[model samples]
Target: MHHDVPLIATVAMAFVLAFAFGFLANRLRLPPLVGYLVAGVMAGPFSPGFVADAALSAQLAEMGVILLMFGVGLHFSAGDLMAVRWVAIPGAVGQILVATLMGVGLAMAWGWSLGAGVVFGLSLSVASTVVLLRALEERNALATPNGRIAVGWLIVEDLAMVLTLVLLPAFAELLGGHADGHGTATGGGLLWSILLTLGKVAAFVALAVMLGPKLVPWLLRQVARTGSRELFTLSVLAVALGIAYGSATIFGVSFALGAFFAGVVLSESDFSHRAAADSLPLQDAFAILFFVSVGMLFDPFVLVEQPLKVLAVLLVITLGKSLAAFAIVQLLGYPVGTALTVSASLAQIGEFSFILAGLGLSMGLLPEEGQDLILAGALLSITLNSVCFMGADWLRERGRARFPAWFDEFGKDRQLGLQGQLDELRRKSQAREEARSLQITSLIERFPIFADLDQAGREDLLMLFRPRTAQPGERIIRVGDRPDAAYFITSGTVLVRVSGQDIRLGPGEFFGEMALLSGRRRTADVTALDYCQFQTLEQRDFRQFVSHHPELRQKLLELVRQRTEMNRQAAAAQAEPVPALPAQG
Candidate 1:
């Protein structure tokens, strides 16, 4: 039967499955990349209902990988790359070589052919940019030192991987005894292929650059003038896909590479973020499916059969690449923390692994096992790369902890000289909430309770004021309940009922301070009957704060004393009868 399933049904099914797994992964806090991979495994040939058309799925995945690479290129500007190149270049290359060598050595030891060994080694050496990028974003580390280096490393790896994809077929064929190292006219043929590919690449870049700057910007300007979002979206897609198709058809280069260059060129224009915001969501969906397709290639049975080979590859992926990257970054004059962290983050096989494997299969450089191995490595690499990256942070802290004593006096002491400059920037970033906290603490410290504290006590108090959210109808304080914390509303409102009388408070009004100051039960019942947010100072923090600020304590004591005196005055006034005046009829 040559009948085919509708594209919508197939793609829809894949998406539904991807969503289900993604949701599950989210619930578990596991990476959604793992979810997509698991989705593929569940929907694959080895599973119950095999619905994937390998060729169709693979073609879609190819498009996805291309777009993903393009996305990477788009986010990373040349300036961004240059800033972190020192760490990225050596870290990425070092990890790749070490992992590759480890993979090849393991294969040889396990009696696998040399060609397969090389392919496996190379494949396992790269990490998943998709996973790493998402993880970095989640951790708010994307703009941090490690994130920049990580992105740079992956960009370099992609370039290297693409080059290897171009060269691997010939290398493998030579090693596999399928062809002479040099063929008759091989020199001419090879040179011609190289020149043609390069010429097309150069031509595409030059043409796109020329056309993109003038044409794209002009078109975008017109679109902006008209203010049609739909048209703008269509135009962006057209630009991306049109450039992609033209490059692929004319030069025989991967559409993915073309899209990447297109993004880079577009980056020079003003519409970059706007386009990215609109288009990246689309890219993310397809790219996830692309990962799922890679999972479709994984056969656990094969790995089980070749368990030794798999384990060996895993070792190379983890240990070999880590060491390789560390050595390279250290050699490049980076601090040990940056060197190790950057190295660990980049140590794994990635998107280009599948790209190379597919190219190799088409060119006869790799057999079925080689392709499968690459696929497995890609999935596992994504899973573990993030783990290694997390370890990199820990390793960084350790490196600083072990920072040389004199490095502080000569190297780091100089950084301390800029403490004022950094402080200025930090103050700006601290925003209003942080500024408020600082102001309040400074005021509190002027009181008797906190006046005696040293610098460290102030630092400890600063850690207690993270923003908190409250649900409608949630009680901030229940009258007569032991108050373990003090609530100061930063925004939103709360209803206070003291002795069955009601009062309302809005921003900057504080409650439970009496309890906090006196270590007593809440005097009022306060409830948030609407969406609200607030900050609470914990009991321990309150006590510590009071202890440190003696003046503040003395002031609070005086206020409490006044409150008691007022209660007595009220009682005495009540005891005295009110004088009544007679009115004339």
Candidate 2:
């Protein structure tokens, strides 16, 4: 019925199936992106469904990439990237080189030209920004050190790809064994071409620096003052799209790169968060469309027709790239968890790969089969990357439990081993002290008992605390014991047994305070259920603190009374007691 309206039909089918598959994927505890790809497949001409307009879908997907990169630039800070620069820079470049070599090797074995191999290899070397960001966002790891490393690594790869895209055509004859209609570039010509490309890129950067800071912020401010949310959102879109198109048309920069710069320029403004929030829905919608567009390009028959070849490509993309990344990260003295996260985040290829392959085919450097194989590889790797993350996490946890001795044994035994060991010990000690201080400060800020204390007072109180750790099943406090200390949990879980009742406490929670304030024996037993880290305040320190701050005594007395009433109310609200479980040793 809607056949005449191809664009409308396509958009409608894409969204409808995307939602259906997204819901199904969610039910199965998978990323909804998987479902969006499936929706694309269903709506594609290859499947027996209402075929969507592939051209229109691709254009919309481009918008998705623009918005997605813009959002990433908004959250990404130079400081965060620099924090992991040592590992990220070398690691990303090294991994790309390794992956490219692997791809070239594969292509040579398949009897393809070196040019085709370079393009194929380069395509597979870079990870998809969308996929990596989505994975990190899902795990809530985007702000973590490892996430920063992964993101920085991605930026490096993108830069490398951009350079490759610029240089490939100039060196086509040397690589492909034949030149296109354009005259072959001599050595001098190649050098000149490279220099020209760099000049243009530098000019773009210069332009951005000159105008972006003042102009972008001013435009956003004007839009903000209009008191119209719609106008503000429209302005953000206009800037993103306008800059992207301008970069591509005038500066020869890619749309994704342009949009990223636009976002970076806007990020300096105070309204950046608001802009991000406003653009989120559109960003998400287009992102799904982007995945769908990629899916529509996939031909499922490749898996059946060239099973071994496709499998080999997938292995190179998923395992080859990941192993290189993992090795590079670990070699830099980062923890196994960080290495795993970085590696898993990069075990797939996407947008850039498609672009590279398309260009290669157009230049007659790549075969149709090469493009098909690349697409198939992208699909398989994206699918398996999710499992790769789960596997890495599992391995990390297993390593922590099974091989603690071997974990910290690396990156030592150099000429400065003694100094390095001393420095390591100092860092660990400082970290522990800082953790305890933060825990104490948080407790002071949160509880009514310490509410009267100012920030300085809390800082003074922090000195009375010391860090402590307890293994699972260890008894930290026993009922009826007169311990002259109070404990506040900093990490992990503890089980509290009181008057035949069991209560679980987690980080920032306190115990032994009631007994300390009441001047009596402990009323409950506290036992660690996991590897717990906490802070302990000793009786002597507490007494000294009270002596210096006499007003705290009155506040403490009032807190004790309030706690007593609350505990009484809690007990009254409890149901009939169940049989007590046997205590763990």
Candidate 3:
């Protein structure tokens, strides 16, 4: 007699194989997602090894989609979505339309049904949020302007897909596809189905927006106060899974949509950052399983049986979509760098494509062969996207180097319009800075030297100071470097090391003054303890200020004398021997 243990066996094999393959892929400088998918194929029924429960894997994959969408919502807000709307909204939607049309043309060539063509086209339209984010993060470009546009474009695609998932069932007949279990609805039935679906979606969004924002954050805070790391992690998971299930059960919304709204509601909270951190590991585990599940559904024979068909699909996804984006961004007057970055970012499809394919297959709108082709295209595009990015980077660097003068002129001309807008922003920022400097100058007046200065004299002194910034662990001043200016700490701390001594300096402290006055190299290494902002008075500026203020000049000399004597004494103390140690011995 055999023990029935499908769940344990499948999970165990999936994890083991995924780890081995993922490690190898990373070692080869490839994305581990490729490895995970390969692992799934090996464990799938199509391959020779132990096959996982297909049904169970599908359910797990759905959970991954839900959580991944939720994570997107958690990190993004309406403001963020709107920030790049000028490019992202039109760019993403237009690219999708173009890609879908290209896919339709390919499907027509293959003599597939309109329903199959629509499904296939949709499957190629959207890029994987996970893959795109990972790619941008790897290149340290996620915080750049192009990255923001890419992310915003992704949000639009996600929202569109969520809408498609909801309506696909209601409009199944129109698309020449069957509805789920129930027969296809038409006329009044179709109208009712559409209204009901829309109503449920609206209700879920309303409830989540109204109640979830308050309750979820409060609940998370309460869990946090319990001071148990395990409980906090559990709470985060519970919120994601519970809200997802409830939305689907009570409101008839898809799990992915529900979870996305749940995350959006929670994103409003101050504790959302911690919540994201707590949920990361669980999210990652499910994401890996998700890729594995997609792999399990893929039939490798599709590549051999229909090589040209698969190539056509890959072209639509990688080339068609990328070209559309590049053209759209360029038309919007962005530089070539921004256009290439956005274009390259969209050259791969993954999670969303898998979801769309699965849905279409379940609805009988897409065939098994179609699903296999989609999976094949996704794999190839993802692998090749790396190569595409490397190429883009090379061209960008070489273009800048080889045609520096030409590129400079071209870049300047392109930036002329942006420069005007930037100038307005700069003026506003300068006004704010001047206000802040006025406050600082008032504080400076409390010092003995500045007390003698009249209002105009103090204003003149402020004009001589220029702002400087340093990041944590940055060396602001190195030993043996000739000093040009003395720095006045405005905020944060710095550590100054001279001869074997370390001195901590806080706001209101100053440094490099002795070097500036004496025309000598710096004796100490000054490093920022944290992000720091300071103001500097150059030697020339200081001398000019002192020339007009003899009393302040005398005060500075006196302080310098005192500091020099203090340093001498400290050095003598450090050199002194410990004579009393003999008595202890």
- Maximum-lDDT candidate: 3
- Candidate 1 global Cα RMSD: 17.1
User: Candidate 3's error at 312, in angstroms?
Assistant: 1.0
> Rank order by lDDT, top first?
3, 2, 1
* Local distance difference test scores for all models: 0.68, 0.79, 0.82
2 or 3, which is superior by TM-score? Answer: 3
Off by over 4 Å in 1: 1-4, 110-118, 166-185, 398-585
Which one is best on TM-score? 3
What RMSD does each model have against the real structure? 17.1, 18.3, 16.3
Q: Give lDDT tens digits, candidate 1, residues 500-540.
A: 45678776666677887877777778888677766667776
User: Candidate 1: what lDDT?
Assistant: 0.68
